[model samples]
Target: MPKPVLIVGAGLSGAVIGRELAEAGHVVHIIDRRSHIAGNCHTARDEASGVMVHVYGPHIFHTNDDEVWRYVNRHMTFMPYVNRVKTTSAGQVYSLPVNLHTINQFFDRTFRPDEARDFIQSQSDPSIGEPVTFEDQALKFVGRELYEAFFEGYTRKQWGCSPADLPASILKRLPVRFSYDDNYFSHLYQGMPEHGYTEMVARILSHDNISIELERNFVRSDAGDFSHVFYSGPLDGYFDYELGRLGYRTLDFEEFQYDGDYQGCAVMNYADADVRYTRVTEHKHFSPWESHERSVCYREYSRACGPDDEPYYPIRLSGEQALLAQYVARARFEQGVTFVGRLGTYRYLDMDVTIREALDTARSCIRAFADGLPLPAFNIEP
Candidate 1:
């Protein structure tokens, strides 16, 4: 007596849940609007360059969660990837995340550990007890100089708005180290999937009972056969935005092939507002193990996600949360339906976070069935 399941949107979150349920002996059916399994993490090798380019953009996998790290490694071998992010800001290129090297390079002073700490402390604004805005938080941590140089313009470019309007929680960590540690991530485990994300997802979804339909027309009424329907598509689209549309930011990546090496690094962020394009990613470097004679490059651009734009980041504007509440309320009232993952929950999530959340959600569902606990509409809170 296996419970039939219907999962929409074959993204990482949906894939994770669908796979888990099928492994637990539940019949599962998964569908995606796109022709691929991996949502944004999809990677395909360019036939011309022999370079595995991130179709959406470069996604660097970095996380401190040990369980998540082990889970992903079980499927694919992860290679070492150090995100030495270089940024062009104020007529000069510098290392990002405001490490010791960046501090030294920008200030034109060879400051030792103590000197750097004291110098930075001198520049930081002490008056602000609690940070209220992105600008306030950045200045409080990295000071006016670094904030202005590194974050201000980049934030503007990425958000298509001023940092001053953004929430302080965004600057949770600026990573000011005493040592000259320029490594971007402080995670215990960090690397890219050996076979790329598409394969990783393909591995996750490979099961006897699970059937995946790609580039399929998804109508909510069409999913009536299943006992429980898991919706991972846009929450608005899920409910047809009975209330109103939630705000979001989308990316526009302009790509081209280069004869040889275009940029030495995999990621070069344009922190200064002077550059029209925010960053140039050389996809070849992402796969350092495989040497490509030629290279592929993508100039990353940020813009407002219009009605038709592929929404990347959830804006969560003032009344949007209330609007989200309306959707959640409607979802709760609906029978045999669970809303999980980024789009369904109306929040941006990293791959690792999405995977972990899906795993936990699956476990929660199984436990709920065993212990007679109630299953939630959401796997994770927004």
Candidate 2:
């Protein structure tokens, strides 16, 4: 009998890789430190409200990759979901992404798309030829008024730092739409799993050759047991933080239940410096397909990740990036192990991207085995 491949972390990365390898005639053993699967994307039903709550905030799967979209759909049904984000700033509500309608409403004028575009251009900082920081990017893209109202406070609270301290790439993710499209993502396929993310992941790992163990903490020494070990845990944790811990921002969700609708929306950003929490997410609105009289919500608070805290977002500042490069060098020298997933790579990856990379990683592993070569430490660059 051939030795089984060991997979540490039963999230989408581990699950997808395990499924693919199993289908290709490899016994795969998956394990996660968390009792449940899906990692941060874990979703479950609230017994009190009967609403499917995103245990660690909401995760709406949106992607342009047809292969990844079709792959997930094969396991479970996906309900169409368009994320229309709303923000409250200075006692006024507004649409997110700073659309044309938002511009007109903010200034109380009927400006056409062209007029709005020209007005924004006039308002932008002409002195800033190149944006080097998050603050510079916002001022250059949307001007001061819109940036202050929509991004400044929210960003400061979310990242626990001044917008100026962050890299310009952080604000580049947000788009300034010319039209009144409130949809958060431009992906062709966007939806939430019909049952839940956990169920979808569970179904994916239901192969005869794949065995999953929950609450199983994996260590570096465990690599001796399997033919090859695919680790999806934090890269720093894998090396016991010998090069010092990589900086990460963790979240604190203050969950509360209310009768009827709480905010009448899935997510509402509190874009005021006085507002302690970054945003409040109403779980019921996440799955509009289901109706519920009571709603569950979470007021999200962001802070520096402690040793015991679950890391949510990687803060890839200059210092952290330098430290990561050292770890990457160390990882390359490590044998019989490959680091995979968001935490392993120390980057913020969406659900679709995670699945796509996992699929590609699995294919690379298979090819390496067939060619009588060792698998590389990372299929996707960190």
Candidate 3:
């Protein structure tokens, strides 16, 4: 180790990796281009509303993994949060996830669970045995009307592509409940950090040896030090795009203020394809424990990431995967720098996966150092 390891980006992934390495008796330096830590998960009180608001968007922590649930619980006090989502489609407001209530209400029927299932099955076509596109998957699983009402337009709006063009696997988790459960996710544990995500991340970097430098930009040429480097920044940037750049989607949030309450729900998705925006997130509902007379809301718009936008979701198109493979090949030939995290690996990962991966990366680094083995370029494949 020549110098302390340099970890670029102070987001959840970078913070986790740095904390793990520092705890394992390795020096780490974290540098992020943003002025604040915690990346997009940053939350703070809106001075006017006096409510904890998610600056980027509403990021509810929900995961089924036991270890991941325990890992986050250790740092921050998590208050139970069930993301009850609704959608306004064709001038009708209904529960999301194609639940029994949504289906019964949307179709103006009072059918019981068994009757609802029979009715939906009757509407579904028996001809298509295998589904390929998002449209096919939704129709095959939840019937044509519910698919059009809930997913078809919404998927197109969110992904900026036709539902027919999207992969069927994307719609595999289309929640169709036999009961009337409106909570968006079926994860066992769901909550938001009591103090907020930023506080949790800052606590993670509270070690003496792990230093952080915000508002600083790092260049690829200077990645030479500390026996190895842990690169959590964008992988395409790391390799300087030896292949062409990957496709990504970034969200644009429009802020609005209101008195008393806003939508009365956390997220109100506009599922109709005609609607330009995806969903409007009311920040007040995110922190149910906190009472605020005024409220903060964000109208979220999804667009294809340009050269200048902050990439949120990796498109991971077939061509981009091939390009990523090329970058992976080039990265393997390089000396020290391990790619770990969402942007680094170019995969859409929630907080739990990032935390687990960072912990694993640190352990891998320790093993490589002890055995005198060459450091890995990437701990996880994109």
Which pairs clash in the backbone of model 2? none
lDDT score at residue 276, model 1, on the 0-100 scale: 78
Candidate 1, residues 91-181: lDDT per residue as tens digits?
7888766767788899998999899899999999999889989999988888998988888898998888899998887777667886777
lDDT of each: 0.85, 0.93, 0.85
Q: Write the per-residue lDDT of candidate 3 for residues 156-247, one digit (tens) a residue.
A: 87888888888787777767887888888888999999989999999989998799888988887667645567777888887676677888
* Tens-place lDDT digits, model 2, residues 278-345: 99999999999999999999999999999999999999999999999999999999999999999999
Q: Residue 107 in model 2: shift from native, Å?
A: 1.2
Residue pairs in clash, model 3 = none
Q: Given candidate 1, what's the lDDT at residue 57?
A: 92
Model 2 segments beyond 4 Å from truth? none
TM-score of each: 0.96, 0.99, 0.96
Which candidate would rank higher by TM-score, 1 or 2? 2
Give the least accurate 10-residue stretch of model 1, judged by summed lDDT: 366-375
